[model samples]
Target: MKIRISWWWLPYGILMLASNMWKSALFLLLVLSLHESAHMMAAKAFHYEVPQVVLYPFGFGASILHLGHGSLWRETLILLAGPCVHLVVPFLLIVLVKFDLISITYANYLEQLNQSVLLFNLLPIYPLDGGRILLNFLHLFLPYCCGLWVNYALSVSLVLYLFHETAVLSFQIVLLFLLFQQLLSWLFIKREKEQFYYYRYLSAPKRIRLKHPFQDCFRAFYNVIRFEKEWMQEKAWIRRYFEKEDLKKRKQSHQIML
Candidate 1:
């Protein structure tokens, strides 16, 4: 997605628009950095590889790579990290501000920005934090399409709510744009589902159905191991039986010749 950093970040940039203030867009970048950094850290905890952090109209996300066989707990932790940091960082900064360690203006800015990031991310829609976390958990019970569509429904509702928000036009606009983007995203996912499943099925030798991308890979790997074990057991059984029969036949032939 050709997301322009300068365009969608107008609300964030307004914070640092004054002369000699270098924090304009950088503060938002810092927010994104915090979010994706947490995700990458959690991903690495499970030996998954994180390649890029994509910042969008809605929020920021990390594109994780080499996530071969992630478990529910692992994905959930990674999903939760963004909000956890958002919540904790502001609280810590407030503590510092109360102790006269940091300026009130700076502290307030951080606090609001953090809150904004958290609020924006926690929208219960797809491509958002609450939505994504919901999807990760939903994968335990339903297919990806089901979870994705649920998120999309929520996002559409969110867009409807935002469109009528009289106080926050920028936020409303951002929400609408995000809703469109994720709607497109959901469609793309639906189209690519068969292809992703096909590759996953082909990659592993065992006959396992592919649904969850990384988890399915693990299932396939386990199936391959099990198949190998069964093949070994059958081979051993056949060899033992055939050898025993051959020896008995030889003994009979020797007796007959005598």
Candidate 2:
């Protein structure tokens, strides 16, 4: 897979080294590498093609060639792999330190590094592993459009909360960058409805939760499907009815214009 480092991180790395935090910087890099490697390994194991690995200031990420690749369950496992590695590695470090194979200072550093990686990555913001997991889970129940909207809303909310809690200018700047990145992603998802729908159909047809018979399919096109015991309609049938109703409305509009 193609690998590239963000030039933006170069200055930050230099700053860390110049400030005598070189060991911490090195440990962060090591943890980030392992986390991303875990994702790559999981993708390969699932037979998914990983096209590129990008090294950002915070961490590294591997981009999977998503088209015709893995299922929702497969993707879930892949998404969880990075965090899973973070969960395991600290215990191993502690054991080594306990056995006097490694210094206690080094073990403490590694433990703190791993914990930071775990916490930052587990933030429920889209594009992160945690966010991806939440979105994928939402797609199982909500319509694709609805899931995207909810994801975007959650991202915005978290960004705002972070801004309120932090006085660190650089960290806040990074949060702002993430906010815009998520906004752009939200727009992209909104614009790619057809492609998204097809992928969703293939990956999660059986798990779709929009099983209710609606009074107006057009109005409910982007609505979340809350599972209710009163609704006896199958999701597929409801979706077909919505499609036909949409087509019928378009035809009527065209006839009126003619």
Candidate 3:
């Protein structure tokens, strides 16, 4: 897959170096790399071809190619893998320190870095892991385009709020750059007719039932089936279908308890 660095990342890297935080910056980049690598591994495991990996100021973003060929659950898993790595690394670091393989101070620094990265990504802003996860969650109930609009709106609002609260010049500049990118996406989505059609198809049901089980498989199937009924006239049928499924599951669960 192709990799490209964001232009904003260049200025941020320079600032870090100028401030004599080059070592910290190097560690941060390595942490981000590990985060993105987790995502790449998940995508690859599912046979999804990642076309590009973009290195941002905070972390890397991977674009999986041929999204239509991939399952939504797989995509969600890929997004989640990044944060999971950050969450899991601290324990591993603790083990290393316990074994005297690494200094406690070094382990603590890495742990803090991982936590920072995790918190930044968990923010509910578009393009971040949290925002993507939120969007995926919304897609479970809302129409695909509606979910995109909501994600964009949340991203815009957060960007503005960050600009207001932020005092750091370098960070403000990065936020502005992110805002610009969001605006461009908004414009494209607004003006392009094909985008609507694409979302519809992208959000369309891939199969009546999942061929194989994966994480959150039932939830994913339910969402797909819900999305399929989104454009249908008879909304009652959709509700009834879900009610029946819920009842069936509850019955099976009760039987297991007995």
Candidate 4:
């Protein structure tokens, strides 16, 4: 997987060094690395390829290309793995302290860092673990598009709220700015995302039955389309959709010729 460091990280690291908090900075990096490693391990467990890992000032984020394309349960587990590492690290630190492998002071600092990272990651912001888990939960009841839109809305709202509450020129403002950038970038590719969703569904259609399949195909992530009391697979629906588009294009061409 490719690794990239965010531009924000350089300034943040410089500040930490200037403040003589190098130990804290090192511990924070260690914690974030462990957290992201857990996610990568979980993704591998589910046979998903991690294309890239981005290191932010606060934490690390991994891009699992096929995440959420298959079983929701597997996706949820992968997302949860990062937080679970934070939960377990404190205990491991305590064990190290007991064995004199680390000082009590160091252990305490690590524990606090662990708690802070865990809470921060659990915030409901898009692309964050908490936001993704919320999206997955919504997908069960809402259509895929609806759930994604809701996720984006909530993420932007929360980021805006945080910005308003933060002090001017504070470090938090930088983090919030980065998060807002991420949301905007994701929004710009909304159409591409929808097309990818359709392609994934068509390529590996799941067997899902619904009372009415005539509804919007993008409504739910796993609902099969039904037409005239017969269930239609994703391939058939996509074929029909393309055929309609082709017919429209042909008619337009004929009119232009005339």
What local distance difference test score does each model get?
A: 0.60, 0.70, 0.69, 0.74
Kindly report which residue stretches of model 3 are placed more than 4 angstroms away from their true locations once superposed: 3-13, 54-60, 66-70, 95-103, 190-258
Best TM-score among the predictions, by candidate number: 4
TM per prediction: 0.62, 0.71, 0.67, 0.78
Cα lDDT over the full model 2: 0.70
Give candidate 4 misplaced runs (Cα > 4 Å): 55-60, 99-102, 166-171, 202-205, 211-222, 226-232, 239-258
Candidate 3 or 2, higher lDDT: 2
Q: Write the per-residue lDDT of candidate 2 for residues 141-221, one digit (tens) a residue.
A: 565567668888998899889989999997799789889988888777634454544444444434333434343211113
Whichever of 1 and 3 has more TM-score, that candidate is: 3
Best by lDDT: 4
For each candidate, C-alpha RMSD in Å? 15.4, 6.6, 14.0, 4.2
Higher-ranked by lDDT: 1 or 2: 2
Off by more than 4 A, model 1: 1-25, 54-61, 66-70, 91-101, 195-258
**lDDT (Cα, 0-100) at 88 in candidate 4:** 81
> How would you encode candidate 4's per-residue C-alpha lDDT over 110-213 as one tens digit per residue?
89878977887788876778888888888777666666778777888888778878786664765676577657746665564546456555555454655444
Model 1 TM-score, 2 decimals: 0.62
lDDT of model 3 at position 143: 49
Counting only residues 3 or more apart in sequence or on different chains, how many pairs clash (N, Cα, C under 3 Å) in candidate 4? 2
- Write candidate 3's Cα lDDT for 144-252 as tens digits: 4566688899899998999999899977986887788788878876333233333334443444543222111222342323333243312233345456667998999
Ranking by TM-score: 4, 2, 3, 1
